[model samples]
Target: MEKEKIDAAQESSPGITRRGFLQTVGIGTLEIAVVGAVAPAVQAETRQRGNLVPLTLKVNGQRHELHVEPRWTLLYVLREKLELTGTKPGCDRGECGACTVLIDDRPRYSCLTLALEADGHEITTVEGLMHGEQLGPVQEAFVQEDGFQCGFCTPGQVVAAEGLLRHTANPDIGEIRTGMSGNLCRCGAYGHIFKAVQRAAILRK
Candidate 1:
């Protein structure tokens, strides 16, 4: 009798089996669990996007008023929002100086700096070093002295040199090395970079 009833049920549900039903239920539960776990995170990100803070940044001799998320990095704002692509994003952490920018004439890693923190402060990127159509002295020196090989780190190196020269005017070989120590060149162009800094100092004077 029981066998007859099981056969009748299987015939009624055409291709459906006990295992298939269990599999469907398991998948449905897993999907519900996944959605439950992901919904809160998505909602939180939406809230964060909605809560943008107003920011005022003075960059490259210009003042800009904009809205930014508190978590946005200065590097992101410069490259993504302001369309300044000169500052390279190298490591993204503070260890690499490829994202170096001038904050009040001092070198700071833009990747590590929060956009909110730079509010109402003077920020200078590699683009800021240009004089209208001509390259700045440090950039010209870098070109003439062949201060870079791959040129990936050249912008940061030039900015760092500018900051160094701002305070020291004429740094000795040792002082140049010390001042530029924060920046790294993967192409092994230290000698030319140092010469470039020296040349930039002369050009600046």
Candidate 2:
């Protein structure tokens, strides 16, 4: 009975064998090897790019200076750096005008435009269209006419309409369609949007 009890105690206590030691060492070595292999690649990538270049953007009547990566798009800088998130990224392929911003009074696709490219240019985002806490005519018309349904594309649509009005004030229905062709409304609010532009024109007059 004494010998049986001693054997049971020995079984209950976990004692590492040579096989277990070897297995532990093997796992540790594999982990070390993985780290050694991956760390250099990560370090190499970190060393590769993202060198800061001087960027000066005149945004919303304010000039801003910053150091940014060469590959950063204007949309990224506008949204991430400047915190102008009114511009939405819908398609990101420039097919959708959701990232529209007025560059020198013309609607530009910020996703396709590089930060460096937008440097030294006047950039007008949706946030700039207000007059001392009052919304611009385009924005007001959009609200009054119920131009937007989802409001995701409203910023671009409003900017595009503003730009169109600058070029063709008091435009007819066909002219409005041709002018606002760049901006796409997924909410099917094109009819209301057209009326909004017309209302904005009348307000301007």
Candidate 1: clashing pairs of residues? none
Model 1, 136: alpha-carbon shift in Å? 0.5
Misplaced by over 4 Å in model 1 are 1-45
Tens digits of lDDT, candidate 2, 50-117: 47788899999999988888888999999878878888898998998999999999999999999999
RMSD of each: 17.6, 16.8
Instruction: Give me candidate 1's TM-score against the actual structure.
Output: 0.79
Task: Please state the error at residue 27 of candidate 1 in Å.
Answer: 31
lDDT (Cα atoms) of all candidates against the true structure: 0.92, 0.89
- Where does the lowest 10-residue lDDT sum fall in candidate 1? 14-23
